[model samples]
Target: MENRQTEQAYSLYKPLLFSLAYRMLGSVMDAEDVVQEAFFTLYKSGSDHIHNMKAYMCKIVTNRCLELLRSTSKQREVYVGTWLPEPLVTTASDETDPMQSYLQKESVTTAYLLLLQQLSYVERAVFLLREAMQYDYDEIADIVGKSSANCRQIFHRAKRSLSVKGVSDTSDRSDLEKATNLVEQFMHALTTGDAARLMKFLSIDAVLLADGGGKVKALTQPLHGHLSISESISSVLKKWPGSFTCRIAMVNGLPGIVVYKDTIMWSVFSFMIRDGRITNLYFVVNPDKLTHVQ
Candidate 1:
């Protein structure tokens, strides 16, 4: 009966647990593992020495996840060119509030998360918990193991630093629209073999990252320079052999282009547009990751 009850409790908290983990780690696989590990710890404890199972479990999960993030920062720094957060599919239920959900559904898209990587892990934690999850300072302090006063300070610092790093980028819908419009023109150039025009739409130091997971042939290294990116885009278009379908879709909460072949989803591409041109490109061609999504 005790074991059965534990399983029931875990089931009830699974969604919340997953959300907490995802917001912390930014990777689905890691989030799933953290939740499993948290539940394992919870089950082994046998519900003893706990006042609130929900909050206690959440604290455990977030701390474990924070530790993991702290350890992984070094690995991420040395990671392959133009690292991006793992792409996730956000559903209607993922929102914290119906109204906030409606507003943020168009705000927190995949492109937004990619930009978020520019933040330190602690800032990301504080911002996501306080802003996204609506956790109070006291609750956030519990999760982060800091004093409530310190938690507020941390969040304040995060906001100030993030402002310099483009936290306002998400709120600026006009900028996103203008940038995405340029991406559409860039894609259209691919089909029309307008190399010069395509080059015009890219920054001189533009970077292209393709997350093919080694399943398909992709640039083993990031493509750099406006000329190089233009050549690559042109070459791929020349080889594509047909009129491909492209649609503007929500990538996380940011505007992104969804690519398809026939009725099947082929790739999800998001652009990093700045200064009236695309400065970077992220192509998530990882078939396994897209399995549950598409």
Candidate 2:
């Protein structure tokens, strides 16, 4: 009966726990592993004495992520090329999966996750719990084992840091529509090999960062300015002799492009739009990172 009850509890909270873990760690495999470990710990300890299973599970996952982050700090510092979070690819129509549902939320977008990466683990936990999960300061304190006042301070500090980066929690519908339309135009330009058309949609100061993890050929440094990026894209396309299929897909809850070569995911392009032009373009081509796309 206890085992059965624990299984039931796992089903009830797995989605929320996985969501929290993924947001905290920014790695799908690590998030899934942490979630499973949390539940296994819960099952072994039994849930009878637990007053709030959801909070308990969140605490476990958050603390585990903090530990993992600390251990991986050196790895990130030494990471080859530009580093990007593993892309959480989703079909535009698959709404039933809990992980998909959580990922579709703005908090899990690659851009937002990168901002969160700017924070310390404690600050990230407090800010995410307070901002993304909508937890109260007191609740956040409990999860992160900080005093309520300290959690409040951490949250404010984190918010201010993101503000310095021009982060906004709110999304405008018109802006979203414009972004989607721009992505469509960008894809069309890419397929048609129209360099001028492609350049038209990019911001003058646009930046492009590609992460290949040194496992594949990729830009070793960011490309700046519209003309540079435009020419780079044109040059790469010209070099390809074999035909590849490209399609606009919803990547990290925004309209993006996915390219497939020999039916395998070759690259994912996500953009950040500002003032009606693409301000930032993230190209993820590391094969290890594409393993989870399907």
Listed in order, each prediction's TM-score against the native is: 0.65, 0.91
For candidate 1, the 10 contiguous residues with the lowest summed lDDT are: 98-107
| Local lDDT at 180 for model 2 | 82
* Model 1 agreement with the true structure over 135-175: per-residue lDDT tens digits: 89998888878899988988888776653453334446677
Output candidate 1 Cα RMSD: 5.4
C-alpha lDDT values of all predictions: 0.70, 0.83
* Alpha carbon deviation, residue 99, candidate 1 (Å): 10
Best by lDDT: 2
User: Mind sharing the TM-score for model 2?
Assistant: 0.91
Clash pairs detected, candidate 1: 108-253, 109-252, 109-253, 109-254, 110-251, 110-252
